[model samples]
Target: MNDIAAIPVWAIIPVSLLLIVGGSIVLIGALGLLRLPSFYQRIHGPAITVTLGAGCLLIASMIYFTVLQSRPVIHEIIISLFLLLTAPIVAMMIMRAAVYRDLRAGKKDAGAAAGGIYQFPEESE
Candidate 1:
């Protein structure tokens, strides 16, 4: 097997910390998705997972590869960028669909208006 570069202890410490923290955040986000009461609230859980968790993981990957190879290993940024951009759109669509479905079912909730249409009061002249 080819010899890998001996990573410095100092570098390893921070990288390890990053990996642990990111993994924990990802786990918490997953827990929130399972525990949250509403669909809208749950929509935000994976955003946190992708943004903080995936972002740190990619950074860790980039750092480790670059250090071992003695070159810029920034290809991991593509995954990070894709997650950051796509997570929000997917979350929003899920939330919107949930709202539409609930409205269609006509469940009476405080925020949900009649016929899913809000009636704004007229301002006095």
Candidate 2:
């Protein structure tokens, strides 16, 4: 569009930079997702994308929109807030579920017992 090309060179540079950085963050998060071992580590991998990558992308969007319209637009904050609250809850639930499954399967060592882990009584077979 004509409007898109009409943006100042300086503004275009920053926007391009923002997009590059945001994309890099997302790429790193994806690599982390694939490289990290175990369910816990894998959970953390996507979280990096959810938190940092999403934040950077949102910032880039805000910058682009603000420059284009010359107005204050901040609706991204709502998304950030929802993600901040929900990501942790979702990650925690996944971790807890994995822990429960591991415990049930006796993969965890006996000395690893701690608070909040599920426990079962010994069976007399």
Candidate 3:
């Protein structure tokens, strides 16, 4: 469209590069989820990379919109902030749930893997 064509080369280049890099990062994270051998390992891939990849994509969006509208478009920052704050907490909660499930199922290795931090319920004789 005319709006896309009107964007200067400088802005276009960074936006394109950001898109490519962000897409690649997200792809890698997806691959990691599929290729990883265990749940613990799998969670790490997306947990780390999704944040970074989304950050890159959000930055790209901010830049593209700011350039297009000729104003400081900062909506992405709020999304980015929310992502930054919640993604890790969600990952941690999921991990804790998994560990608790494993412990409940009598998987001693899960507690060991968690560095003995989880309190196992006492068994009454």
lDDT of 1: 0.75
Q: What is the C-alpha RMSD of each candidate to the true structure, in Å?
A: 5.5, 3.3, 1.5
Q: What pairs collide in candidate 2?
A: none
Reference-based TM-score, model 3: 0.91
**How does model 2 score by TM-score?**
0.78
lDDT of 2 by residue, 47-122 (tens): 7577777777777787777778888878978887888788878877877777777777877442233454465666
Q: What are the Cα lDDT values of the candidates?
A: 0.75, 0.75, 0.91
Where model 2 places Cα greater than 4 Å from the true spot, the runs are 109-125
- The residue-level lDDT of candidate 1 at 125 comes to 95
Predicted structure 1, TM vs. truth = 0.79
Extract clashing residue pairs from model 3: none
Residue-level lDDT of model 3, residues 3-122, one tens digit each, is: 999899999999999999999999999999999988978998999999999999999999999999999999999999999999999999999999889888887677555577776877
What's each prediction's clash count? 0, 0, 0
